[model samples]
Target: MTNSTRCGECILPDSLPGVNLDKDGTCNYCRDFARKEDRNPHLSADERLRRLERLVAPYRKRGREYDCLVPVSGGKDSMLVLYAACRLLHLRVLAYNFDNGFQSARARENIQAAVKTLGVDLITYKPNEKLLDQLFKLFLTRTGEFCTPCNLIIQAAAYRIASQNGIPLILSGGSSRVFGGIQGVSQSKYADRAYFKNVLQGHVDFREAKRFVVENPWKRAVRRYTRTGPNLVDVLDYVYPGLEQTRDLLEKELGWRPTSDELEHGDCVLNPLKDYLQNRKWGYSEVTQSYSSLVRTKQMTREEALDHAEEEETRQPPAVLESFLNRIGMSREEFEQTKHRHFTEFPNYPQSRWYRMGKKAVALMRKVV
Candidate 1:
């Protein structure tokens, strides 16, 4: 969209390829949030902490001490959960991470430092790289979506670990919009396990999910075959902070610093892959739309998140992009042609080569336009 008519408060406008503005001088998304919030008051930090404490307390009984399982990536949000549980609430935490095949060394180092600094027990689960790479390409090129499967695998493993260890609660750093807004009813996208289960079911087969995780040799040998025989932990039994509140506490109180390469999605290296696939699958970056929506909704300041979005835009290196495309066996010609096709259709789904790819790609690509 044209800069002139872009929302006075945010970096979105009608000129945004497929964006629509509302009478309130905000985008339709911003207006939607405003309406949602108008209906309810947002939760406060104390309330959020109380909710979290209540969730964690039952598991922290005298004989049983572990409070929760936190899925961390050494990013701002996960660290937010880490520090809040240990430093703020004084609860025992199990810091869990999934070493997806594509993580940056810096991210790995950050994870180590976070574990050491927080003095929390760290548990890592890594899968077979060869199979993961194949799956990544198949999902990205054929399905045009890798995150749904990747996140499901990680979450499944993390909860299984927690359940095996008898940790009754699973805490998540998903409270960004729930407490960030000043008005009633904060804006956010995270929900409970049922929601996530539905999300996973929509994309992948539950029976096949076990196969995907077992395909990882390390996990199969160390985790699956071990005594911990596939445990399922309850997810709703925990509290979490909203994005802004969590960031503030983590950086200010616990000395957690965000890595230089983090995007609006935080320090996950898988983000570049997500951005690439989304941008390729659709004409616009999902981060652009998601962050811009956060700005428009006033959950985050337009200037702050927009700058983060722009900064993230520049962080995608040419070499990494080239490597990812090459790894996926996608030719530059095919990639460019996809972009051209999407732009030409502009706001319409381009299904010209529909028969060539699989059903997943057709379905995921259709969601974008």
Candidate 2:
């Protein structure tokens, strides 16, 4: 099949689901950001700092220990958040890392350096490696992707740790404005335990399925109902220096070293395989999404973003791919069969009446908030 069309202004290709191009050859995302920019003024760094201070002042020294839990992957974004919390906002912070056994050596070093230099406490949580391997194999064979468990565990562990420690806030480095609008599939439909179990019902034993899927409904309820339940906030929404400025700050202030790979994907060794599969399935990868964001923000010219995206799109690390397959006990034939399988064929969360009601309740809560 031939490739889909691309945005005239950015590297966002027309292959993305639900994306539309206007008569001017710009995609909806670029047009939306442009419209918002015309309607509202961008917040200055000083204004961001003032707003952050006001939001954080009441929480300062409220608990006996740290004021917030900052999840770090030693990526530039997380490093900036850690620096802002300790140096800029002057809040006592606890840095948390969830090691999924795929972290690169440089990422580990960066995490260690950030915590040591900032003088914040560090906590690393490692999941059961055997169970993780089984889940990865199952997902790769059944669902065509294997990051669902990793993402779910990271979020749940962060919230659970915060609740257990009496910390009321969990500061994450994720930002919708900087890292949004790129997903090909609906994550909420498949990125939860309910969907996971739906897929694994017959493939694996019930006990193994119970161990692999890590969603605790009681914990979720406690987090929602209790006053001390951790509140997750994105640091970037308040204090977003452009990407270039943030990189410069990391190098100058924190002695961070840049990697040849994209920093946003972190140090996962399995990312190349995932990106390759994404390219095969949707004709684009996370690099396209990230560089498109940079182009829209005017941090990088479209030409530069296109160059970077092209390089990422074509390159495949054979050794990493082979190692990942071996670790997950997936043979080459299985890998090929899984890669060719259509993404929609995979089992996902059913859109039942209860699910629809839950979505409406969430929307109402958002409006009230």
**CA deviation > 4 Å runs, candidate 1:** 1-9, 13-19, 176-255, 261-266, 280-283, 293-311, 314-317, 326-369
Count backbone overlaps in model 2.
Answer: 0
lDDT of 2 at 2: 32
Query: What is candidate 2's lDDT per residue for 42-105, written digit by digit as tens?
Result: 7788998898888878777753798999998878888888999999998889899989999978
Candidate 1 — what's its lDDT? Answer: 0.55
Error of 1 at 303 (Å): 4.2
lDDT (Cα, tens digit) per residue for candidate 1, span 264-322: 35455556655664444432355555566566545677778767766554333334667
The 10-residue segment of model 2 with minimum total lDDT is 180-189
In model 1, how large is the Cα lDDT of residue 354? Answer: 37
Per-candidate count of clashing residue pairs (backbone under 3 Å): 11, 0
Model 2: pairs clashing at backbone N, Cα or C within 3 Å: none
